[model samples]
Target: MASEPQYRALFLGAGPQMQCGVGQFTRLLGEWIEKAEPGSCTTLTLTRSEGSFTEIWGAVGSARSVVCNFPIVAWKRVMFTPLLAMAMARLRRRKTVLIQHEWAGLHWLRRITYIPALLLANTIVMFSPLVRRELAEDSLVGWTAKKCVLAPLPPNIEAPAGMAASDLRRRLVAARQDGRLVIGHFGSIYPAKQPNALLEIGAILKQRGLRPLIVYVGSFIRGTDNVEEEFHARATELGIADDVIVSGFVASDHEVFGLFGAVDGFCYPLDEGLTARRSSVLACVQAGRPLIVTGPALPDEFDHHARFKELIDRGAIVLVPRGSSADAYADGIVAALKRPPVQAAFDFDGWWQDVANAVRAQL
Candidate 1:
């Protein structure tokens, strides 16, 4: 498995069939690198059939360095590919960098599964201090910190220059005009994100005689868990099934942001609370609407981020106490409605350039 190095970096990623924020980030970053210098970066988005060790070995051998992002959609079986690729890279004395978005955010099993890969990586990149704080609890934290670098993730999806009114956006805006609260949740719906918790908040909104329309501008991530089924079942049990809208995998940024424009605000009640790595929340924040999210677990959570620092300061991002009940969350949603829209702008393109540069420096 040998070839003349033709690329500056070879990015190992998942295919489009699995839609997740990390997947988008991986694609965007690779594209950005390729655009900056044509033929310098190549992305290997492996389908199920494409995960053979030979394919990974060839891809890694063709590049000066290998870069892999973790926990992609449907990564259950496919996760082994990148793990094996990085390990193989080490055995061959090749450079391999592991860009870990979050540690404790994932299930314990996933954290344990990634240990070997992390150990093999010549560089360990983290998006936020939250990951660092949590990794500190583990014995490997000391080892990982030695090779770690911090790089902030740009918004995975940014609003277009203009919000062209779409049919759905018009309808949602109409409902808002009629005194209904249009709540939105973006990105793939998974259990750790607690998307169904929004349904609980919506149900509470319903009982109080407030007509709430819960809009999910994303698809469900099908996995071993019954998260998708349970989400639907809960909406049905709470008598809000009809009120729930699931926009399965909207590919257009304009369309997605148009939906964001329609909602009075966005709700992301993540069980892990707000962290720098939540690019989904960052994308929603760019819509200028209030974001009702679980508050940070630590006081200086966003200290590393200047953009979020401004957003939180302007009251654009409302923080609810962690471990709050559904009733409390419902109240937070109502209170967020009264805040003025955020006029501050986020420089997504600049952020991308920064992230790309940081990654290249390590590679």
Candidate 2:
């Protein structure tokens, strides 16, 4: 109730409407806060308009907490900054935390506007080492490190029960019977995601007489220069267009999980520049799907990578070196496909409990 102030927290960054890493980070934080301290905390999310802030607001009202999910472009010469600063000042007397999820300083002016709000917060949470490293590189972390804490993004949904290894192998065999080796990727299509690499891998597979079906699931954000179309065109140019299937944005979790379950292997060939920890890899791990992730080296704290490597040492996920060519990555996939699938004993509930403890300690 407003009569007794709750531990107010403001999640500031673009959100799921933007369908980017930051958006996913904010959404997960909101979930963790609610689940951890139910009825004891209030959340306010500031994101872009495309983000369904209002929809999330309707879901969580002003009773136990208020969801102030609003869109304000910081670079604009609007009065939003003054309004936000005023709001932050008013909420300062309450137990408040401001969480910034963005790693890139896209608009220098926008960073200038948002920096003060972050500095004034009781605590600042960085979702990954990449985020912290970015801040440090920009001298932002020096200003906020005492208040900064590293908390990687959690999976948006709980891991689902996966099909047994026997069932998955049988399905893969059936898919192969169609003369296609199922290779897939999920999440929003962006240049940073490197969809072209998938096309390259498809070409390589075809060269080896292995028909490759590259499936992409997720929609593109509006006005990002239509990178998805470019990817499709490039796939065609690569001579593997017929093998590519771009199924844009499956809405249901079951559909997404099913897609992952049916695939032979998943690819995440992210370019090195865009470095924020990803939850997609976590989803793959939870689904018990084999993976081929490409980016700068992942932090040791990533549970899936650690577990996958452990399993590899124990003869589980087939681990290959980074920068391995499409052929090498394909080899890893083939090896993984042939091996027996062994699901890791992930403690999802325990993971949430750890998150709860972190929030409690902060409070």
Q: Root-mean-square deviation of each candidate, in angstroms?
A: 3.2, 6.3
lDDT of 1 by residue, 60-121 (tens): 77888888886554457577777788877887678988888877767777778878777888
TM-score, one value per model: 0.86, 0.72
The lDDT of each candidate is: 0.81, 0.57
Residue-level lDDT tens digits of model 2 in 100-157: 5554533455567566555555566555666565666676545675666755344555
Pairs of colliding residues, candidate 1: none
C-alpha-based local distance difference test score of model 2: 0.57
Winning model by lDDT:
1
